[model samples]
Target: MEFRILTESSDWQGIIGEIWRFKGAPNDRNNPILPSYWQFLQIRLPELPETPIPKLATLSWFLREEQKRDWVDHRLVSIDPTLHVFSPTTEQVVFFWHGRNPSQGVIHPDFGEPGGSPWYDERPRLPRLRVEPSVVSNPSPGHLMPRPAFSPALTSAPGQVRKPKALSIILPYHNDPSHLFVPLQPFPDTRHTQTKTFQFPSRYYPLRFSQSNPNHEPILTNDTNEAWPASELEGLWLGSYGPHGTEVLYLHSPEECRINAWKVTGDVNVPRGVITWRFHSRYQTGPECIPPAAGLDSLPESCRIFKGSAHVCGTGFIPALESWIDCIVVVFDRDDIKVYWESLRHTSRYRRYKGRDISLETVPNESDSGIRVPPVWD
Candidate 1:
């Protein structure tokens, strides 16, 4: 067994002396002197006289002589210091301390006696001490377990034709048609048509179509009061009325709107299926433009642009309108747009400032247009 001695002090002689005082009376038969202590004394104190004297008797004589000469305090010498020993191999711990027994004025059962002064060996041989060796081995191949085989029927077969998954459409405000309608500037020729050309309050503007049908005219039908003909309805389009320089437009349909559609063909590099749009005031300014002053409270009243995209999915016919609609539309308001923009800006700015070892305790106020200033931490 491997033994380690952990001690708070390096005064070995003081420790030994402390152990000797409580090592029991001189006539006790069951003396607690341990084999380890005998080995320690043999190696550490070979200069002691070889005269035969009982271990307890020698210790008593030395202690008395020191006390009489006032060389050491008898009271201090009687202290029983504890020794902690640990055997790693055996996983055993032994705490040895010399003290008087409660039942009889003798050494405690757990303490070991100091080795006697006149140590003698009656037997020719002492028991040999050896540490048992630990064994380590790798698991055998026979013990290895194999993974269970999966069923081939559960996997797709070669040359199998997989059906396209239906895209899920989340309607804004429970599929309210009023929310889906987007207004746009009238066509150029309609500028003087005398049919309320500039602002058709009752008509819903159609910004895009699935197919390029020039024959399809923008006829304001009294029955539906729509700006465009029903036959031309084919894809999806997002439109917002902003100042000339800040207009944002997104159009997607079966044919003409394909350019704006995010194509998902199982490739990771390409954005697929569902797409979302949210208005962020910060990015409204062009790249070359500087951020406006923070004191500005609100956006320009003239720029009352409705900015946001409606989610659309699948192709189906609306029984109520008796028209075929290719996509479902979901719209969001200015409040939703503002919230999204603020959250994104806060997160991005936090990461950037943190990387530069700067504190973002107080964020700068947004400008009049509600556009947050880009953070630049030194």
Candidate 2:
């Protein structure tokens, strides 16, 4: 079957907000705007399949200039249900966290147990380079470098007899050419017994300073540095680094981490209010624990460590929403996740109305609690 690509304008802010709320953002007194420890990508498949297991080939995100493309191989990890109990929509959404399977295609009987470990691998295994040198216009600014033309040969893995269909998507960017999400630097070399803490000004948020709004002021005014307790950094954190920023931080453990940073359009300093921390450890397993590296490679066999200088935005911060879009495109076998997709796609309003609401609602005197109410006219 030919590969099919479905594109949509992702409500990333709203989605992040919903996930934050699901993780107890309202009751979080410390940092209400802070996101939880776990982060997820909700995929709405084009068509539902009959089988329970959805066949996803790959998932990719068209990011800012520097790290032009971020791709994940399904063979490395599979998408599973989100840790949180709440979802914004009635669409039977399936949440998938970030991590890799150490066993490499091996299925665990428990499945839910920490079946596979997580590791970062920057090896150039794919047929095409994530950052194509041929299409790069300006070598100075990484993000502005154009992506190389796509070909079916580039998409297929080496030695695979059957080739999957190829689909190329062109994502639009409205912000300045030089400003892009700063790519995470390579993890510093360290011995197994050593514990190193590296700190740098994060370029997660677009630099948008307003002389009027004090709330818009950056936490890192100068080159000031702050030491964060590893224990305190357990949950998800949503904050900006630049003058204007939108970024997600997922700290599964002291060793494992995942981040989603973007230079979005508009004066929105940080999505869903200011930078804050949301604690949701109950919903997450610690970062994938990888065994120690024995040989030359410091990291495990399939893992790669990322640690480097933080990124910063270039000039030209546009306030138009139509200028850019946050999108995630997945190439999966048509059959994978079909049943779940169909259930969500075809869910009836009446059935949703009949169902009880399990989301937490804040009351005047009472603490935030999950309130179940029948669907009705406001």
Candidate 3:
């Protein structure tokens, strides 16, 4: 029932307003959020609001609205964390763009109202860098840069084979607290026991855990000392790379199915280089299943179910489990995708930059139940 979006730049308030407008309600009665942009997000699927979504709350924002004017300049609402209400079995959490500018693009009517709206000409598309098609033409002299020289052993005999680049991709949540991947007998935790057979709630279920019992605190206990956290992860991103475009990517899965994660696979053309991705996943699977793999041909690889723990306690001592992989960032160059796991890594330090905020939740629908889609956002 919670959602969040992280950004390097601040403008969170304005982005909130944009999301409201996309829902067909742009201005707030007292304070308004403006001058924003949201290109990435991480949200829970079942908690998306439906036909008549109630009040929206901001759990945490980059800067307090009370202290600054146009905090949008340097301080943006970098991360937006909110718990929402929705019918679990009835609605699907969709991630789409929101805006009032025709120059920007379009807006969805059902985003807020199905037909009741001063609808824009078109709905806005998710923000993203477009990838150029691979040109088959001959490379110019300067463009045809030489590949880095390989060790002589690689070119030794006529029958010798070139080795594939060994990419030691680690999707770590926190800087590696490297414990030898040992078999632990379910770290004496009760949450795992209570959630052992808990079925994912259907969309029609109106009452939320927080709503039903405000007294219920997310599992909090001290193994060595004391603790605290929230349900959604903040500062989330993805990372991956392959020798040629990415041939494979392995990331940790979510501990629970409560939140719906996202990943976009395409061509990301930066001034420095190009990142092309052939596949992306928004998969929900168990720890026992083999980790899912994406095929190079665009077909999503089946989520590999496996048994393990990648759970971290968030703001309220809430156990944030990787029920699903949230967002995957893929960078592409000639034939390789430079995927950075920054999204997956949990760093204590904060990075600063200038930009707008984006606060769109993943609205889940019944039709999308158990279905996996690529290009989740843009």
Candidate 4:
């Protein structure tokens, strides 16, 4: 979706307040632009199999649910605006910019997960490169960066069938060229929408909103191999580097949500991290948890909260349990919760929740010992 900021401003709320004065640029008449945030964001049924889960709320009531979810729309990680070239393959989203500043560039993997066991593979496998820029321009919105294009070492027979390769493209913050990781033609698993559980190879690193045992915390023993936890973490995504290195982002799902939380087991790297630990959902309705001082602490003291509009009336509503829907985006280190966006329903008088609402208490009570599973396949 293309969003041409009519009047760009970092203050999102302020722009929202002055929406009455909003107008799309005249040059972009070919695109459908709405007068509200609805125009800035687009919603289409994800290209995935329909879930069989029963719906409790009516479609007419779903608008109010969306509004309640929008309250925290700002909390979602922002995609860099300078990114003009977006490469969405079966394996990952590769972004390229011609003149983007690399120094200020930081690739935020939609799926960032650091420090964990071999969720899929243990030993480090070399990255594969695909997608030859010289041959193609404007690849389909979600197309695969075929391996043979980039990697000469790839060996695939003429008639014998081969599995579709998954690619992970990694590059510096700002660079004209990018690299891809196309594993052996047929990786252990190549199903794009398929999700699985895996463990971290290390102990539960401290991440906020996660529980930790004081006694089991890593100690600075005299052993030379025992390296203490990292104090400064760049960020967490669905994929992680090997025991010593990092890779480009490699995750693709038109319909998928990844969640990760830090945890410790009797053995290191058995299960993946959980998004939220059990805590009281009810708060005092004031400044709740004190923000942990910026340092080595991995946990986020403040879990993100999203609120949207009225599903029924298409009017605004207060933050209520029924009004707020819960949607979680789990990766390797950080887990983000999203409530749906609100809109007016065709019918209905009362408001309703659009999606699900997640809080400490509302989070599912799944076993923390088993391998952490991706929410999409679940």
CA deviation > 4 Å runs, candidate 3? 1-232, 241-260, 266-378
- TM-score on alpha carbons, each prediction: 0.15, 0.19, 0.15, 0.16
Root-mean-square deviation per candidate: 41.3, 25.0, 25.8, 24.3
lDDT of 3 at 6: 32
For each predicted model, how many residue pairs clash, with residues at least 3 apart or on different chains? 4, 26, 77, 48
Tell me model 1's lDDT, rounded to 2 decimals: 0.20
Error of 1 at 355 (Å): 46
By TM-score, rank the candidates, best first: 2, 4, 3, 1
* TM-score top scorer: 2
lDDT of candidate 2 over 1-378, digit per residue (tens): 011122223422112101121133233222212222111232333335588877543332222121333452322222221111111111110111112321111110111011121111123222232421111111111221232322000010112121111112221222212122222212211111011221111111111111222243322222212222223222332332322232433322333232222212112222221111222212221113212221122322221222211221111111221122211111011101000111112100100011113233222223311111222222
Candidate with more favorable, higher TM-score: 1 or 4:
4
- Estimate the TM-score for candidate 3: 0.15
Residue-by-residue lDDT tens digits, candidate 1, 1-378 = 101231223322211221111122344321121111110110122234468752321111112221254434345534322112211121111111112321111111110111210111123221122322221122221221121322000101112121111111111222122111222222111111212222111110112213335454433222222223222322332222111111112223333212122211101111122232332222222212212321123433222122233222211111221222121111111111111121112100000001111122222432211111223222
User: Lowest-lDDT window of 10 residues in candidate 3?
Assistant: 151-160
